[model samples]
Structure formats: C-alpha cells, structure tokens
Target: MAGSIATAGVVCAVGIAAAALVGIGAAAAESQRAAGIADAAALAAADTLAGFAAGDPCSRAGEIAAAQAGSVTACDIDGLIATVTIETRFGAIPVTAIARAGPPL
Candidate 1:
C-alpha cells in the first residue's frame, strides 16, 4: 500500500511537470507570434511612411496587426522610420512586442 501511494505521488508530480512545460511552451509561442506581428506591422507602417504605400502609416500598422490576430497598441512614425507595438493573448495573459523598421541610417 505504501509503495502504491508513492507511485501515485510520482505520477501526480510528473503530470504537474508536464502541464507546466506545456504552459511554458504555449507562452513562448505566443511571444514569438506577437513579435512577428509587431515586426510585420512596423514594416508595413514604415513602407507607408516612406511613400512606398498609401494611406496613414499607423492605420496600416493596425491593419497588419489585426490580420495576424493581434492589436496595435501604439504606432509612431519618425521621418521614414516606423515604430509599432502590438499585443496578443495566450490564455488569460497578454503578450506585447515592439518593432521598428526603416532604411539604414
């Protein structure tokens, strides 16, 4: 009976560890997704800001981020450079990432 209890305890611990690892992996994936979205949005905005694309730069950033299942939290344009911050979610947690795009200085 004691051995059976110890086996059950070990199983429980292992299960908990597996769940934690899965959660961590999911968070990492969400982070990466947010980063990609921010980068893409920033690039799109920069293109607009640089006159390579039409429409407002920040609006373009919002559209790009929205298409990727993210929201643009902020966008700023400095000359030909564009900066974008985006937010995405993993479960109940919010993941945010920022990126800047422009020609070489």
Candidate 2:
C-alpha cells in the first residue's frame, strides 16, 4: 500500500508539471502574437507618416497603426514616435514599438 501511494504521488506530480508546461507554452504564443502585432502596426504607421506633410504625423500614424493592429489596443504616436500596448489572457502585458525616419544624410 505504501508503494502504491508513492506511485500515485509521482503520477500527480508529473501531471501537474505537464499542465504547467502547457500553460507556459500558451503564454509564449500569446507574447509572440502581441510582438508581431506591434511590429506590423509600427511599420504601417511609419509608412503612412512618410506620405503625409509634417502636421499631426503622430495622429495620422496612430490611425494607420490601429487599422493594422486589429483587435489589439490602439497605437500611440507622437510625432515620429509610435507605441502600442497589448494585454494577454493571463494579465495586462504591454508591448511597445517605435518607428522613426530621419533625413537622408
């Protein structure tokens, strides 16, 4: 009976470890998705800004960023700067990306 109990404990520990691994995998996937979204949004915003004059470039960039980000949080843009915040199921995880274009030297 003691041996049986020890075996059961080992199984339970293994099961718990498996569950934790799965959870970690899911979190990693979510993080990757968020990062991809941020990157795309920043690039899109930068492209939009390139065509615009020099007035409210950030707001214009933000609009483009929002469109590309889809369900993610709205993009924040200030002048040539762009930022994005994303939250996952576990908690609020903020992802940020910036885009800048300088004069040709």
Candidate 3:
C-alpha cells in the first residue's frame, strides 16, 4: 500500500508539471501574438505618418490593433517614425506590448 501511494504521488506531480508547462506555453503564445499586433500597428502608423498611407497615424494604428483583437493604448509619432503600445488579454491577465516603426536606422 505504501508503494502504491508513492507511485500515485509521483504521477500526480508529473501531471501537475505537465499542466504548468502547458499554461506557460499558452501564455508565451499570447505574448507573441500581442507583440506581432503591436508591430503591425506601429508599421501602419509609420506608413501613414510618412504619407505612404492616408489617415491619421494614431488612428491607423488603432484600426490595425482592433482588427487583431487588441487595443492601442498609446501611440506616438516623431517625424516619420511611429511608436505604438497595445494591450490584449492572455487568459485572465492583461498583456501589453510596444513596438516602434519608421525609416531604416
């Protein structure tokens, strides 16, 4: 009976470790998604600011972020450069990402 209990305890620990790994992987994927959205939003804003696209820079950034199920919490434009910060949810936690796009430097 003692050996059986030990085996069960080991199995439970392994199962818990697997679950934690899966949760971590999911959070990482969500973070990557947010980063990608931030990049795209920044690029859109930069393109608009550079006159390669027609629209207000921050407005363009908001549109791009919204399409990807994110919200642009902040946007800043400097000359032809654009920086964008976006927020999205990862499970119950809030995930935020920032990106800057502009002429090659």
Candidate 4:
C-alpha cells in the first residue's frame, strides 16, 4: 500500500510538471502573436509619420492593433520612425510587445 502511494505521488508530480510546461508553451505563443501585432502596427504608424498616410500616427497604430485583436499601449514617433507597444491576453496572462519601424539608413 505504501509503495502504491509513493508511485501515485510520483505520477501526480509528473502530471503537474506537464501542466506547467503546457502553460509556458501557451504563454510563449501569445508573446509571439503580440510581437507580430506590434510590428505591423509600428509599420503602419511609421507610414503616417513619413507623410505617406493620413491621420495621426498613434491612432493608426491603435487601429492596426485593434484589427489584430490587441491593444496599443503606447506609440512614439521620431522623424520618420515609429515605435509601438501592444498588449494581448492569454487566459489571465497579459503579454506585451514593442516594435519599431523606420526606413533604412
């Protein structure tokens, strides 16, 4: 009986470790998605900053982020460059990503 209990405990521990790994993998995937959204938003906003698009740069970034099911937390434009931060959620976990877009020097 005692040996059986020990075996059950080991199995429980392994199960918990597997669950943790799965959670970590999910968080990583969410992080990647957030990054992609931020990159696209930054590029869109940079176009506005460069006078290739109309409307405010930050507003354009927010629109792009919204289309990707994310929210733009911040946006900054310097000259023709644009930097954007975006936020996304996976379950109760919140993931944030920042990206900058600019013309090649």
Best by TM-score: 3
Quote the positional error of residue 47 for candidate 2 in Å: 0.7
Prediction 2 global C-alpha lDDT:
0.57
| Residue 71 miss distance in model 2 (angstroms) | 4.8
**Which of the two candidates, 1 or 3, achieves a greater TM-score against the reference?**
3
TM for candidate 4 is: 0.87
What does candidate 2's lDDT look like per residue over 1-105, in tens digits?
999999999999999999999988977876676566556656555555565444454455455545645343555656645555433343555444333442233
The positional error of residue 96 in candidate 4, measured at the CA in angstroms, is 1.7
RMSD of 2: 4.6
Ranking by TM-score: 3, 1, 4, 2
Backbone clashes in model 2: 0
Give the alpha carbon lDDT tens digit for every residue of 1-105 in model 4: 999999999999999999999998988899999999999999999988888999999999999999999999999888899999999999877889999998988
Taking the tens digit of each residue's C-alpha lDDT, what string does model 1 give over 1-105? 999999999999999999999999988988998999999999999899888999999999999999999999999888998999999988888899999999988
Comparing candidate 3 with candidate 4, which one achieves the higher TM-score? 3
Q: All candidates' TM-scores?
A: 0.95, 0.61, 0.96, 0.87
In model 4, which residue pairs have backbone atoms overlapping below 3 Å? Answer: none
Better of 1 and 2 by lDDT: 1
> Superposing every Cα of model 3 onto the true structure, what RMSD results?
0.8
Index of the highest-lDDT prediction: 3
